[model samples]
Structure formats: structure tokens, C-alpha cells
Target: MDTELLKTFLEVSRTRHFGRAAEALYLTQSAVSFRIRQLENQLGVNLFTRHRNNIRLTAAGEKLLPYAETLMNTWQAARKEVAHTSRHNEFSIGASASLWECLLNDWLGRLYQASSNLQFEARIAQRQSLVKQLHERQLDLLITTESPKMDEFSSQLLGHFTLALYAAEPAQMKADLNYLRLEWGPDFQQHEVGLLASDDVPSLTTSSAELARQQLSPLNGCTWLPMSWAKERGNLHAVADSATLSRPLYAIWLQNSDKQTQIRDILKTSVLD
Candidate 1:
């Protein structure tokens, strides 16, 4: 019934010596003995068998050991959960580095404009990491080019976009131009394999479109990038006869979350939809 009494009981049980337990608990030996007496009286059980110098638990005390441990664990967890809820109204979001570079940043900007008061944390990770975070409920939402196959999560078709090959200069000398591979996903990689020569592997490969663009913008190299990203910068033009690749973006969240309604509302009205 009394958590303090349980704490005293646990400490005394651990040390098996009243004086040692008191030292560990930063209390006087008399105070520790009084607590044990009070606990025994309340429970109507003699918890410990004390000889001249030896101490051992009684049968009733042994029976309560497991339950006391459980009670302490549950109490600590409750305190942590309550403190987290009281300290912050937080929304944690995660996505692949490619998605963040291509489109999710714009979506985040829009979300900030729509709900200025919303406190959110954004993480850029690989697809596997993001999916793991979602399953663990560490991430409230995930945005990605590919939807997860797991049924425990709900995904929505946020929008579709195109990726086109671009270069800082025209491909007059194809042999001289370096290629930067922007890793969108397996699907994009498979699609790209057919478009290049058998011997034409990339000079550099990057998971981020922004990083790819940074290299391409100055080096006159060719790389595929989202149309939205390409349009904003100058001195870049689509390579002649290059195929435009179409990709879909999805917003994924846990299916049975307590914040399900709030997440749906935000997704529905947010600019990402």
C-alpha cells in the first residue's frame, strides 16, 4: 500500500542487515528498523527472521518479492510517461534522406505555415531505420517514395512527381560528362539501369538528391532529380532524349495510434496531400 515502505523493505532485503540498509538509504539505523516494523504491522506478517547477526526472508516475504518488484517497475514507468506528457506536445517525423532532399522539406515548410504551434522533430534516415522507428512508435509519421508492405501501418498517396536527367551543360561530349547517381530506391535503380550504357556506371552515388545537385551544379555532371528541385535552380537543363521517371510519395502512420484522428486531420488538410 505504501511505496516508501516497499522501498525500505526492498533495501533491507537486499542488504540483509539493518545498519547496511540504513547506510545505503541515507537514513539512521533506528529509522530503518522503525520502517520495517511499521510495514510488518500494516501487512500483519513477520517479513524477516532475525538472529543475533543473520537475517533471512520469511515465506510471506518471499511470496511478496515478485509482486513488490512488479509494483516498483509499474510505478517508475507511470512516472516517466506522465512526465513526458506534461513536458512536451511533440510530433516526431522520419523519412529517407532522398525523400527529405526531394520533397519532404517543402512539405515540412508547409506544415509549419499551417500549424505554427505544432512542435515537431524531423529525422532523415534509411528506409529500414524509418520503418523500425514507426513500428516502435518513436516516429509519429514517415514520408517516403516507397510505401511499406506491413499492414500494421496506414499509408496514403500524398502525391506524384517526376525525376528527369539534368546537367549543368548540354551533353555535347557524352564521354567527358561524369554521372552522379541519385539513389531514390530499388525501383528507380532498376529503371535507370536500362537507360545507361552497359559500361556506364556512375562516377558517384549519393542517397540525397540535394547532395547530388550540389555536385552536379558545379561539375557539369548529369543526374536524375525531382522536377520541383530542378526548377528552382538556374544553369541546369534536361539532357536530350532522357526519359522522365514518375514516382509516388506516401505518408505513413501507425494504424491504431491514439493520435490517429489528429494525424489524419493533419494529412488531409496539409499541403502534402
Candidate 2:
């Protein structure tokens, strides 16, 4: 089967509208219909049921979805592997936006400076999306604050960072302060519950620390931030009685990865501090 046909099928399945799929794939509507027909003919099964504006996958199409995704990911990985030269290598790394901002950006910079022939593809996304990519072999490594509890992958502790409550006024009472919540991770949330009162609701919630800091003001709110980051900003003052939390940063990859040595070498240069 031509991979392009599978690609078109996947796109159509995702959009559920031929016109939308065509727009996304940069093809004519007729061309999109032709590809779907060709795929259905090849498989000898009706992949979709078309009823006016409603388009839905048939049973066969639903069954093929997971397999199609796996095939596409495998093909992409194979192409990248085959394209590598003797002196140059490529790797794909993923992390959350905050992780990139707080830690991995510097680590990536160090990798580029030290490894002349190494090339990297960096993806910033939420933890769930990054984990999915890692599981599908679409990412070579994932950097996250929490370790995945799966046996199919291995995680190594890169370093630790401290998060502390910071406010515009150092003496502001916790009850009177407007709280801005940052989604650090599940473990951090568990730790946070003990530090905060049950009725203390966040006025604003965000996943990016930078955004949290930008939105904070003398009269607006206080939030948990990296101790190092908060100290650098002269306007932000540490809360006197707030509890400090320590978070471990981790580098995760497939246990049976072929590029383990290279990944290890790259991680050696990571400096979270």
C-alpha cells in the first residue's frame, strides 16, 4: 500500500469532512475523494459512511486507525534513521513549554555548542502529548518533571529545582493574597494541597511559569515559581511563611532504544541549575 494513501485516509478520518481534509492536505476535494475511494477499493471495505454533512468512519476504518498511526510513525522513524550520515546524527526531543523555558532550553544550547555534528528537533507540548509521542517512537527523548510509571520506558533524574511562593509584597497574608496556580505536575499538586487552604481558589491558572509571572502584579496575585527564576526578578518578593517545594527533573526514553548511548551522551551536558 502506498503510504500517501494511508496518509490521506488518516487525514480524512481525523477531519471527518472531505472538504476540510482536502484543505488540510492541500489537495482538491475531488482528489481527496479519489484517494479515499482508492484506499477503500484496495482494502475491499467501506471506510466511511457519507450522509450529507455528516461523515463517520465505518467499522473497518475504526479498526484500522491504530495500525495506520503505528505504520506512519514507524515509516517516519525509518526514514530518519536511513538519512543519517557517518559524521552527523539527528535526534527528536520533546518537553512541556515550561520545561523548555525553565531547563531544557539551556541544555539544548549546550548540546549544540558541544556537538558539532549533532542535529536536534525540539517539540514543546503538554505532558500527555509528549508522552504519547515518546510511546509511539516519534520522540527520542522526553524531559518532564514527573517520571512516567510505565515499564516500557526508562527515566533518569537530570536534576532538581525548587519552587516557592512569591508575591509582590513580602508581608502579604496568604488569606488576603490572590493566588495564581501553575500546573507543575501531579506530584507537585499533591504537595501543594498541604500548603494551601482548602478554600483558597486560584484567581488565574496557567501552565507556563513565564505567563504566570507576567500576569502577576502588586495588586493582582501571587504564584508558585522556580526559586531561581523568582529571585532574578527584582519586583517579585518571596513569601515569608510559604512552604518551599522541590521537584525532580527527568529525562525519559524507551528502554530498548538503539540510540541509548547517544541519548546518554547528550543528557550528560544537561545543567538544570
Per-residue lDDT of 119 in model 1: 66
Residue 32, candidate 1: Cα error in Å is: 14
lDDT of 1 by residue, 215-264 (tens): 87567678888777788766677887577888988888889877786587
lDDT of each: 0.80, 0.83
Query: Candidate 1 regions off by >4 Å?
Result: 1-88, 171-176, 195-200, 217-220, 270-273
- TM-scores of the models, in the given order? 0.65, 0.65
Q: Could you tell me the lDDT of residue 254 within candidate 1?
A: 89
